[model samples]
Target: MAVTVISLVVAFLYGGPQALFLCVILGILEVSLSFDNAVINATVLRRMSEFWQRIFLTVGILIAVFGMRLVFPLAIVWIASGLGPIAALDLALNPPPDGAAYFPNGDPSYETLITDAHPQIAAFGGMFLLMLFLHFILEDREIKWLEWLERPLAKAGKLEQLEVVVATALLLITATVIAPDDKVSTVMIAGALGMITYIAVNGLGEMFHVPEEGEEPEGGPSGLAKATGKAGFFLFLYLEVLDASFSFDGVIGAFAITSDPIIIALGLGFIGAMFVRSITIFLVRKGTLSDYVYLEHGAHWAIGALALILLYSIGTHVPEVITGLVGVALIGAALGSSIYRNRKIAAREGEDAVKTSIP
Candidate 1:
């Protein structure tokens, strides 16, 4: 809260009251869109020791804010435009006077360049998130928010490497059928890397986190599979990748609000990302996941939706508002179910207590 207030004050100084207002809106939107992220973060974070958790909140935020929001975008522009690092930074700092119209012989603005690169960006982030959602769908969990849907999916998971086969097919269709003729290879390559990254990080963590001869495995009922040393490093990398995937949407979406990269870095990275980390820690400390039960299921569902949305955005424009709303709706439904279940259980327990008293 203090950080939020301070940020707003700083924003006010930066561009007066209007900038302050924009910051607030960006913060709220980011938090809403990232509700699923907090849930997913808690799932991974609880497995880490307190030391790593601190690293996540501190060092992780720096990478998320300055690295992804600022430098990542710049890097994208740099590579896409084939410009030197300093030239790319200069281009970002001085976007074209008007985004909608291009001069006959002028270069595309920073916003235009980033917007043009959406297909590749979407390809990479979408596939990574799709793999995440697929893993959750394939896992055999005791709890299910939508059993009618999840049970059949779980049964289908018996097939060997089914997720990989399905993901590859989807990538091929998107690349060949959906992508522009010129961009087909770009989409395929980016999406393939996304898939490989997910597999390598997730597999390494599981492979290395095996318990030593004496000790019980650490992950709780959810089968988180955690460890220190190399395992922790992989887990940390996984978390960073997860953040990058989540931020892809926000980074692109912010252009809809403002094209100024500096303001975006401040709004999304400084205030918005910080709030997300705080929410993750709060969920971990409160044991919210253990209590809510279906919350994690909802988060994964939201992620699946987001992955599809990202893939769709490659061919068409999608409003950022829709993306944020979808996440909030799934999470809200799961929370409602959890509350109802808790009440029913409490009522039954009360009846049992009364019967015992009568005896």
Candidate 2:
């Protein structure tokens, strides 16, 4: 509550009452877009130790707010303009010159700089998310959704690192066919980096993971043991990467709503990130995935849709509303399916109990 009040005050002080209102709207927009992210985060977070969870709330939030929301944009500007960090910061704070090509009204704004870099950002984020979705679907699991498609992928998973191959192929195809001539190299490079990041983080997590007794070597342990220091360290890295990937769209999308870096950081960083962490913890405590049975499936499908949209966006302008709604629709359908299944089971159990009583 205190943090929220302070952030709002800062927003108001920075840009008056209108900025404060925009900040609140941006925060809500971020949360709405990232509901699927919360579900996906919970899926991995439940496996982490309590200490790590605390770190996610504290250290993770700082990185999300300051590092990605603030520093990252500055770094991008620096790289793009060959300017120093201080210069980039100045550019972001000061409005773009009048009649600039980037803004709708030819107003000079930081939004122009960030929007110009969208292709690379989209390529990187798209590939990373694609790999994540593919990894989940291609792996063998007890629960299945869309088995007709998933079954083949699961069978193909028998091959070592098949997901990497598929991701590479898709990236190549996207760069060759869809990317503009000037942006081709940028797309390829960003996409490769995204894929490499996912592989490195995932490998590190698996390297330190220790299987519990009687666990199948392939199945691995369900969760990391609190005593294993290395396990916690690598899991922390994985979680951070996951959070960053989830933030990619939100960070980019936030620019559409506001050009002010301070407002963007305070709104999306503080409110949206805090809510996501809270949702993760709530899901973990309630065992929501296990109870629903299909929620995880829904989240992954939503991820797949997001991945495709990111890739498609490289060639065309896809509205943020469409991107967000696709996820909500998939997750909503999954929840409905889960409720129906639960009721059916309850009805069968009740019938069996009544028969036994009659006897």
Evaluate model 2: give its lDDT. 0.83
Best by lDDT: 1
Task: Spell out the clash pairs found in candidate 2.
Answer: 96-108
Writing each residue's lDDT as its tens digit, candidate 1 over 56-175 gives 999999999889888988888888789888988888777665555343467777788888888999999999999999998987777887999899999998887888988899899888
CA deviation > 4 Å runs, candidate 1:
99-105, 210-215, 218-226
Candidate 2 deviant stretches above 4 angstroms:
97-99, 102-109, 210-228
Error of 2 at 192 (Å): 0.8
The alpha-carbon deviation from the true structure for residue 239 of candidate 1, after best TM-score superposition, in angstroms, is 0.7
1-359: candidate 2 lDDT, tens digit per residue: 66778888998998999999988987887777788888998877777778887888899889989988888887787877777887778778776556254546543356777887888998998998899999998899877866788788899998998888989998998898888888999999999999999888888877766454456444544444532477777777787888888787888888878777888899988877777778888998899988898899999999989988888888888888898899999999988988888999999999999999995
Give the range where candidate 1 is weakest over 10 consecutive residues by summed lDDT.
219-228
